[model samples]
Target: MTYLPLPQPRTTPVRVMTIAGSDSGGGAGIQADMRTFALLGVHGLVAVTAVTVQNSMGVKGFHEIPLDVIAGQIDAVASDIGVQAAKTGMLASSAIIDTVAGAWRQQGLAGAVPLVVDPVCASMHGDPLLHPSALNSLKEQLFPLATVVTPNLDEVRLIVDVEVVDDASQRDAARALHALGPQWVLVKGGHLRTSSRAPDLLFDGTEFREFDAPRIDTGHDHGAGDTLAAAVASALAHGYTVPDAVAFGKRWVTECLRAAYPLGQGHGPVSALFRLNE
Candidate 1:
């Protein structure tokens, strides 16, 4: 009997990297990023900048990884695995942020690969993730190199030094962030209580677009922002435009939130594998 040859895989999986913290709870940061990447059909690489002793209740403590190690991780991934796109989250300190920025430039990933900056300043429980002193460095060193910057309402306030109380103020914040040099800015209005719709504003210097979803009235969305930012990077790696990627990310996060389940004692996490269960 003659045996037929097996089919070979033709396309290489898109590789995307996450330079962020590791959540011991497996909800956000590197865990969330890797989950999102896999769900979106991309290979996920991680350059852990910090490790958090966090649970669904809150972040108890964190340890920032050394700058050299952080740089080495990025170098290893970019030199060999080769990142198609990347995202930054929970960069703990100014030193790590600086190291990451330097590595990005040194590895020639600035314009070669799309970078999504999730300026994660605080946790869902209002615990500060980034040091106060590191804010300036993050905006100065990383924002300019970012292809897109994704900030929630609280993060927008922290980065732009303005209160986003209304739709007009949200627009102002997006424009202000765009001035910092990211090609695009996504101002997530998930925390807006007055509005029935969760309106997220996207601005690209010249034009503004809005993406809205019905607010999921659940408190189980612990890692929603990280998941959304990771999804955007994954979409970018899969060859979607910035606007389209953001839209896709928003939709995916909405699904995750809608399918969220109870985890620990407090705020739980959105289900990254919700699509699989469905």
Candidate 2:
């Protein structure tokens, strides 16, 4: 009998986790994160905090997952599979935020796992994803623990209570958010109507760097924020520095947006698998 060589142990891929909601439309939240992780060659794990009924048109409704269950999911993944980095999105309420924060501390993941926080306050279609009452808790409990916080203009306005109407105000917003204790703050300026270039500012308390990409004239960027944050976390899991990871994420998101395709009626999702075709 021919003896086959014993199968060698498979090398484990870099692992990342996303603590976020579930988009039934599969455009954002856990679905988008998983897709971005896969595209970046990382093993994706998830702890879903909410399940949203949404489509391209808008968010119809949502239901938050139980606090214990959310904690259990994190514990199971971190204790066994092991997470190198993680990202949070669409944490609907203060209870969910507190639970996630407690899990991060109790699991001893603080300072060990790089966390990218996407303060998802509203949907792309202008529907509220987070409760207004939960905003303070999210800032107080989760922002300090974040390695980096990615917030769009609207989210920045909500967090810093400032009007980000122009580039100057956008920079101010970035600084304000950086003051909240995140090691870095990325204020997405895609909504700035005054500029032709889509510029995002990164503030690390002492320095400010801008990443500019040509603005794509398209309405298919429904999951762009989720995609960018997940890609950054995946890069972090692969040992990239925070700045480098954000740069890579920006390029990746730009490409995804460039290759976006129409799906549902209103707005479609950026193509997370765009690289595959290249």
- Which digits, one per residue and each the tens of the lDDT, describe model 1 over residues 45-116? 999999999999999999999899999999998999799999999998999899999999999999889999
Q: Give candidate 2's TM-score.
A: 0.95
Model 2 stretches with alpha carbons more than 4 Å out: 1-9
Candidate lDDT scores, in order, read: 0.90, 0.89
Cα shift from native, residue 30, model 2 (Å): 0.8
| Alpha carbon RMSD to native, model 1 | 5.0
> In candidate 2, how many Å is residue 52 off?
0.7
For model 1, the superposed segments whose C-alpha errors exceed 4 Å read 1-11
